[model samples]
Target: MTTNKSQDSLQQQLASLPQDVQPGRDLWQGIELAITQQPSATDKAKPKSWVYGAVAASILVPAVAVWISISSLSGPVEPGLDSAALIAQLSEQYESQKSSLLVTYQDKPALTDNWQSQLTELEDAAAAIKSALKHDPNNVALLRMLQTVYQQQIDLIERVHAPKWQQI
Candidate 1:
């Protein structure tokens, strides 16, 4: 019963309100004036030069810093430090190390049967990189990749032959 009375009161209040009430003044005139008026030069949005400069500096400063650091670290190449010679020297060392490791592990069976295949794959990759280096003997990236592959092969050989349990 109380809900019904409250609902009736709400309906009465809604009915008493004017449905078609008009504004005291016509709003279109003000709207039209605002729309037709040109914005003042000062009111128009301007690109802030300092903000752009700040943004550019934020990007450019780090880039320039990185380039400078890299250039400084690399320094000028020494005439005697030939890439081919370096590659050859490193390859000789790697082969010697690999041979020694194989000899050390010759009596031990590898933990994984597929380790030799994996090593073969790495050797293939190394061969490809070396071939690439031959075409571009001065390529540092290729040299690094070849070095990494050789290291990986060595690591794989060591890990498979010398299982962690055996170390303990």
Candidate 2:
């Protein structure tokens, strides 16, 4: 067949071609000079790696020893004051002061608009958080929120009454 004859001729032509052809520019001299200019990186890294390991060990050994010593010397810390009772006592104080301030400022002109409304909002938030605490007595976050709202109520009461209202 013509296909088989053409395939055989192409193989014969490929076989007749030269195996190696020389490049016009010389390349060996630059390669030899570069090799002679420096030692292998692996050889240089051997001593450098040993020095780095020694430095790391020197720093880490003392730090680890100090940490172990300090940990062994300290006793366990004491737990803090009872948050529930503390909140209740502070709340009582704030309510007493707030009642007196309300009586004093009942007829006075407020410096800021809707200041009473702000106090009422804070009181509402505190009441809600306190009711939540009654249901979830051991909730830390609820206790913290109740304390924060109570403090806000006290601060609002003091601010609206004392400094500005006293001058008037």
Candidate 3:
């Protein structure tokens, strides 16, 4: 009879507790939204790829333009040697030859002042031969005559001036 009384008291305590303690929502609907609302993997890379492509094109276009402009500005043809260059070369040759002849004359001061005229004529002849030689570098007769004229003028100046350098 005591066991029966204890069992009754336990049942009465359980019946007195509250029954509305659990929270509620639609779990299936939440799972469907999470799975269906995400963007596709293929859609994520398009804008970044286009941005990189546009930047590369922008850099390449200006680089090609600059290269073309510089190429055009420099032009495509080689410049030819003009008459001034030839004349300057002849003048240089004449000066060098005359300087050598003048030194030779100065070394032997016994030469006549009249030899100056002959020296001038030899210089003129050398200039003429140089002009001709520019057109034909292999003209043997012209070169021989040019050398002969040069030597003749030198010999004449040496005869009129002091003895030859070896003799001195």
Candidate 4:
């Protein structure tokens, strides 16, 4: 009797169970649906990426500004012309204008009058170039040319006006 009862229970359990041992299509579909609905790690990292972007911008802005400042301060440099050449060119122009400059002046009683003013302008320009030469002693060609121009200007002025009252 016991053996028959045991067999009957086993048969009832087997009838209640599903035929397939593996999961159904609905179970696999539910698992895939749940995984697809979850949030990704990249979405959480967006704010961190923005922070890194800010850091990069902060560093780049100052570097660009410093580069521009340096470039502007130096200005453009010509390959052939140095500071000495610039001084010589200015001195040449000064000498070329000396005759016309003196003629424009009229005889006046005050020492500060006509000729004096023109001389003063030439003197100032020469002084500035001389000062620049002191800082750059290597440009011998420019230095020699400027000295010659300055000496010539002085000699011409002395030769032209010998009598003090004739100039007056």
Using TM-score as the measure, which candidate wins?
Answer: 1
> Candidate 3, after superposition: displacement of residue 131 in Å?
0.9
Q: Once superposed on the true structure, which residue ranges of model 4 sit more than 4 Å away at CA?
A: 1-74, 104-125, 137-168
- For model 1, how does the per-residue alpha-carbon lDDT over 1-168 read when each residue is reduced to its tens digit? 999999999999999999998989999999999999998886666656787688467435544543443343254555665667666766776787789779878998988899989999999999999899889776656766876787788789888997656642
Worst 10 residues of 4 by lDDT: 104-113
Give the alpha carbon lDDT tens digit for every residue of 80-121 in model 2. 534356457646655665675577668866667888799889
Clashing pairs in 2: none
lDDT of candidate model 4 versus the reference: 0.56
Model 4 TM-score (2 dp) = 0.27
Q: What lDDT would each prediction earn against the true structure?
A: 0.75, 0.65, 0.58, 0.56
How are the candidates ranked when ordered by lDDT, highest leading? 1, 2, 3, 4
Q: How many clashes show up per model?
A: 0, 0, 3, 0
In model 4, residue pairs whose N, Cα or C atoms come closer than 3 Å (at least 3 residues apart or on different chains), thus clashing, are none
Pairs that collide in candidate 1 are none
Between candidates 2 and 3, the lDDT winner:
2
For model 3, the superposed segments whose C-alpha errors exceed 4 Å read 1-111, 163-168
Candidate 4 local lDDT, 1-168, one digit each (tens): 999999999999999999879755558777888888866876764566676677457535544543443343254554554655545554554455455335533242334336555656667766865886768734554455455546556544543443345532
